[model samples]
Target: MGKHLESDGPSSFSRDTVKAIISQFLGFLLDAYDLTMILTIAPVLAVVLFPPSSSLLATFNVIFAYSLTIIFRPLGSAIFGHLGDKLGRRTDLIITVLGLGITSALTAALPTYAQVGILSYILFVIIRIGVGIFAGGEYAAGHPFAMEWTPYKWRGFISGLVQGGFSFGSMLTAAVLSLFISTFGVKGLETYAWRYLFLTTLIPAVIALAIRLSMKETPIFSDLKAQNKIRKSPFLDLFRKPYRRDFFQVMLFMTGLFFYSYSLFAFVPTILEHKPSVFSLSTANHIYTIGTVAAFFGAVLFGTLTQIVGRRRLALIWAVITFIVSIPMYYMLMYGASIGNVAIATIAVIIIGIIAQGPWGMIPIYLSERFKASMRSSGLGFGYSSGIFLGGWFSIYVPLMHEYLFKSIDTPTNVWFSTAVLLMIGAVIVGIGQYLGPETLGTRLSE
Candidate 1:
C-alpha cells in the first residue's frame, strides 16, 4: 500500500486526465438520456403500437420494450469489454459512442403499429436491443478510461462525478421530454412530437464524438502497452486465477446497485400520474426532474465522503438506510398523493433519491480499484454488467411481487410493497457483498 500509493502531485491534474473525465461524463450523459428517453416516449408509442382497447397489454408491452434493452446489455459488455482490454479503451469507446448515437437516431424513422402491424413493434425492439448493447459497451470502456487517468486521492470524487452524469442525464431527459409532452398534450404526443423528440438524440453523440476525437489513451494503458502486459483473450482471462474471485464479488455489488436504481426509476411515474389525483404529466415530470437533481447532488456528496469513510463502510451504511426507509418513504409518497399534497411527495422523492443513489457514486472508484490494471476494463465491465442477469428483471419482478403481496394489484399501493421488498433484498446483497470484499479507498491502480 505504501509503495503503490499516489501523491496529489502536478501530474494528478494533467491535461489528459481532464479530457478523460470530460469525455466520460459527457458520454455517459448521452447514454442515460437516450436510454431513458424511451420511458417517457413509450407512453406515446403505446398509442401507435396497440389497439385503443389494449390497456394492460399496452403498459406491459411498453415496459418490456425497455426491459429488452436492459437484459441484452451483458452481451455488449462481453464483446466491448474484450475490445477495451485488447485494442484499448480509447478505440473501443469511440466505436461505441458512434453506434449508440446512430442507433438512437434511427428510432425516429421506424414505422408504427398501424402502418405495419406487429412488424413496427419488432423493429422498435431491434433498435432498443442495439441501444442496450452499445450502452453496455460504453460502460465497459468509459469508467476504466476515466478512473485510470484519475489520481488516487481524488478517485472517489471523480467516481462520483462521472457516475453522477447518469443522474444528470436522467434528470435532463425528464425535464426536456416532460416539458415537451406538457406543451403538446396527449394528442400531439401521438402525432409529430414523438418523432421530433427522438430525432434530438443525435445531439449527445455529436458532442461526445467531438470530445473523444481530441482525447488520448490513459497513462496506465499506455504503460501496459509499452510493457506488453495487455492480456490476450481478456474476457476469458477473467475466469482464470487471481482475477475471477474479485470479478464475481464486484458483480454482486453491482447487482444490488441496479436493483434499487431500477425500482426507484421505473415505476415512480405511474405513482405520480395515476395514483395521486390532481397530478398530471406536467406536474409529475417536475417531480421527476427535481428528484433526479437531488440524486446528482447526492451522488457527488457521497463520492466526496467516501474519501473519508471508506467505500465498503459507506456502502453498508447506505444499503441499510435504503432498506429501512424503503417502505415508509413510499408510504409517504402515496399518502401525499392521496390527500392532494405535492409537498410531501416531493420530500419523499428527495429523501429517497439521496439514500438510494449515493452508492452509485462510490461504486465507480470501488470497482476500478478492485481489479489489476491489466484486466481492469474487462473485469469492471463484465463484473458490473453481469448483475443485470438477476437485477434488471425489476420491470417483471415488480408486477410479480405486487401480485405475491396483495394477491392482486391495488391502485393505491401500486408496487410499493414490492419495491420495499426489492430494496431490502438489494440492501442485503450489497451490504454483505461489499462488506465481505476489500475496502479499496485511496488505493492506487497497479499493473
Candidate 2:
C-alpha cells in the first residue's frame, strides 16, 4: 500500500482519478436509467402494442422485448470491447455513449400501434436491440477504463461507488416517473409523458460524452501501446490458454450477480403490484425507491468490506447468508404484503437488497484485476456482459418453474417459493465461482 501510494503520489485519489470515476459512474447511471425506462412503463406499453383483452400476452411480449436487449448485449461487448482494447477506452466509450443517446432519442420518437399497427411493436423491439448493443459496450469499456485509473488501495471504494450508479439510475427513473405522473397524470403518461422518460436522458448522455472527451487514455493502455503489446484481437484473446480459464470463472460469478440483481431488485415492484389489493401503485413505487436507496449504500458498505476482508471471503459470507435466509426473506416479503403490512415488506425489501446487490460493488475492480491489461478491457466487458446469456434468463425461468412446481399459477404463491429458490441457486453459483477464482484483493491493475 505504501509503495503504491508513493508511486501514485501521497493521495490515493487524485483529481483525475475522481474525474474518471465520476465520468464512468454517470455513464453507467445513464445506461441503467435508459434501460429501466422500458420497465417503468412496460405495462402501459404492452397495452398500446397489443389488444387490452390479452393483457398477459402483451406483458410477456414487452418482457421478451426487454430480454432481447439482454441477450444481444454480447455482440456489443465483443464489438465495443474490441474497440476499447484496440483503440483506447476513451474513444470506445465516446462511441458507445453517443450510440446510446441516439438510440434513446429514436425510441422516444417511435410510432405507436394506433399509428402503425405491428410496425410499432417491431420498431420498438429494434430500438431496444440497439440499446442492448450500446449498453453492453458501455460497461465493457467504461468499467476497465475507470478501474485502470484508480490507485490500488482505493479500488474497493471506487468499485463500490461506481457500481452503485446502477441503483441510483434506477431510482432516478422512479423519481422522474413519479414527477411526470403528477404533472401529466396517468393519462398523460400513455399519451405523451413517456417520451420525456426516454428523451430526458439525452442531456445526461451529452454530459457523459463531454466527460469522456476530456479524459485522457488510461496509463496502462497507453503504456501497452508504447510497448507495442496491444493484442491483435482483444475479444478473441480471452479464449487463449490461461485467459480462457479466467474468462469463464469471471463469467460464472457475473452470471450469479445478474441473477441476484434480477431476482430481488428487478422482481420486487412487480411482486408488490401483483399482491391482492395490498399496496397501490404509488405505494409500490415508493417501496421500490426505498429498496434501491438501501441497495446503493449496501453496495458501498460491502465493497468497502471486500477491500479489508478479501473478495473471496466477503463473497462467500454473503452467499452463505443469502442461501440460509432466502426462503425466510422472501416469506417476509410475501407475508407483509399479504397482511397489508407495508412497513414489514419494505424492511424485508431493504435487507434483501443489501445482502443480494451489495457485493456487486467489488465487480469492476475484481474483474479488471483478473486479467492483464492486454485482455483487461475485453475480458472484463465480455465476461461481465456474457453472464446475461444464462443468468439474464433466470427471470423468465422463475414463472415457468413455478407453474411446473406448484401446479398452480392460480394465485401469488408461485412468487414467494419460486423466487426464493432461484435466488438461492444464483447465490450458490456466486459462492462457487468466488471460491474457485483467484483472490485478487491486493493485486495491482497491471498484475
Candidate 3:
C-alpha cells in the first residue's frame, strides 16, 4: 500500500489547515476578479486604449486582449503544472500568486493610448499575457491542493463553495465597475477610473499570499512525498494510455463550460454597450451582478446534487439545459427596451447563469479524483488550461460574425445570435462527453 496520511477530519481543522482553505478560495476569487476585470472594462478599454479613427479595430483589440489571456493560459498551466507536480503545489502556488499580483499592479500603471499612442495597447497585451501565465496555475494547483486536504464526505460542498468563488469575483467586478462609473461618469471611467479597478486586484493577492505562507503542504501530497511516489515527469504521464482518457474527457467538458460561460460573462458586455442597446451599461452591469449571485447558488446546488446523483449525470443534465435555453435566452436579452423586455432579459440571464455555471461546481473534485496525488496538479492544470485555451478562441468569432452577419442589422441581435450558436455547439459537445465519462462521487483521494 502507498503511504497514507489522515484526511482533515469533519469536525475540526487546525488553524493552518483552515488558513489554507481560505487562501485557496481567495486565490480562486481573486483569479476570477483579475481575469473578469478586463471584461468589466472592455467598453472603457475600447475607448481609452484605441483611437476613434477606427472603431472596428478598437473593438477587435478589446476581444483580442481577452482572448489572448485565455489562449495563453495553457502555457502557464503546462509550465506550472509541471512545477507543482514535481516540486510542490504550495511552492508553485506562491510563485503564481506573486506573478499575478505584480502583473495587475503594472497593468494599472500603464499609460492610456491617448497619452502614449499604440505603445499603450502593446503594454496592455503584454501585461494581460503575464496575467494569463500566473492565472493558468492558480486553480489547477489550488483545487487539487484544497480538495486533497478535505474529508471525502464534504468534498462536494467545499468544491462547490470554492468554485463559486469565481462567481464572487464576477459579481465583485460588476459592483466595483458600477461604483466607478457612478463616481467618475463615462469619460472619467475611460480615463482614470479603469486604473483603480486593476489596482483592486492587489487586495486578494495579499490575502491569499499571507494565508498560503502560514500553511503546510497538504497531507495527501506529503504522504506521497514520504513514500517517494512522486513522478519524475507527471506531465508526460498525462498523455500515456492510463491517464489520457480522463485528461481528454475533462478537457472536453471544460471546453464547453468555458465557451458558454465566457461568452455570457465576458463577450456580452461589449454587446450591451452597443448603441441602441436594450440595456444601458450600468443596467447591464447590474443585471450581470444579479446573474452572478444566481450563479453562485447554482454552483453550490449542483455541487450538492452531484454527491447524490453523481457528477456525470449532473453535468449531462445541465449540458442539455444549456443547449436548449441558450438561444431563446439570447433572443430575450435582445428584446426591446420595454420594461417587459428588460424583465425578460433579466430573468433569462439569471437562469443562464444558473445553467452555465452549475456543472462547474463538481469540476474541481471530479478532476482531482481522476488522478493520483503523484501527478494530480499537472494533469488537472493541463486539461483545464487546454480546454480554456481552445474554448477562448471562440471569442474572436463573436465580433467577426456580428460585423459580418448583421452589420446592417442591430449589433445586439448580431452578438446574441452569434454567441448563442457557439454556446449550443459547446453544450452538445459536453453532453456527449459526459455521457461517456465515469462517475466518481465519494471516492477517496488516495484511492
- Alpha carbon lDDT at 334, candidate 3: 65
Q: Could you give the candidate ranking by lDDT, starting with the highest?
A: 2, 1, 3
lDDT of each: 0.80, 0.80, 0.77
Q: Give per-residue CA lDDT, model 2, range 142-244, as digits (tens).
A: 9988888887777788899899998888789778877877788777788877777778989879998888888888888888899998889878989988679
lDDT of 1 at 327: 82
**What is the TM-score of each predicted model, taking all chains together?**
0.95, 0.94, 0.93
**Cα RMSD for candidates in order:** 1.9, 2.2, 2.9
- Give the per-residue lDDT digits (tens) of candidate 3, residues 1-447: 221223433334556556767877788888878767777677678888888855545666787887876778888888898888878889988998888888877878988888899999889889888888888888768888878777666777878888888888888888888898889987888878778878888888998898888778877787788888889899899999888988888888788888767767775665555545656778878877888888888888888888778888888878888888887877666663323355766787788778778788887888887777788888888888878757887767666667777555445433667777777878987898787677777566763
lDDT of 1 by residue, 1-447 (tens): 552457522246788888888888887888888866776555667887776754444765777788867788888889998999888999989999999999988988988888898898899889989988998899798999988888777777999999999888889888888778778876887876778777787887888888888888887888889999988878888888877888788888888888878766776665665544457667777886777888888898999899889888888888878888888987777677667688988998887778777788976777778877787778888887888888987778777777666424345336556676777898888887888798787566757
Residue pair clashes in candidate 1: none
Full-model lDDT, candidate 1 = 0.80
User: Which structure among the candidates has the greatest TM-score?
Assistant: 1
Q: What is the lDDT, from 0 to 100, of the residue 103 in candidate 3?
A: 89
Counted clashes in each candidate structure = 0, 0, 0
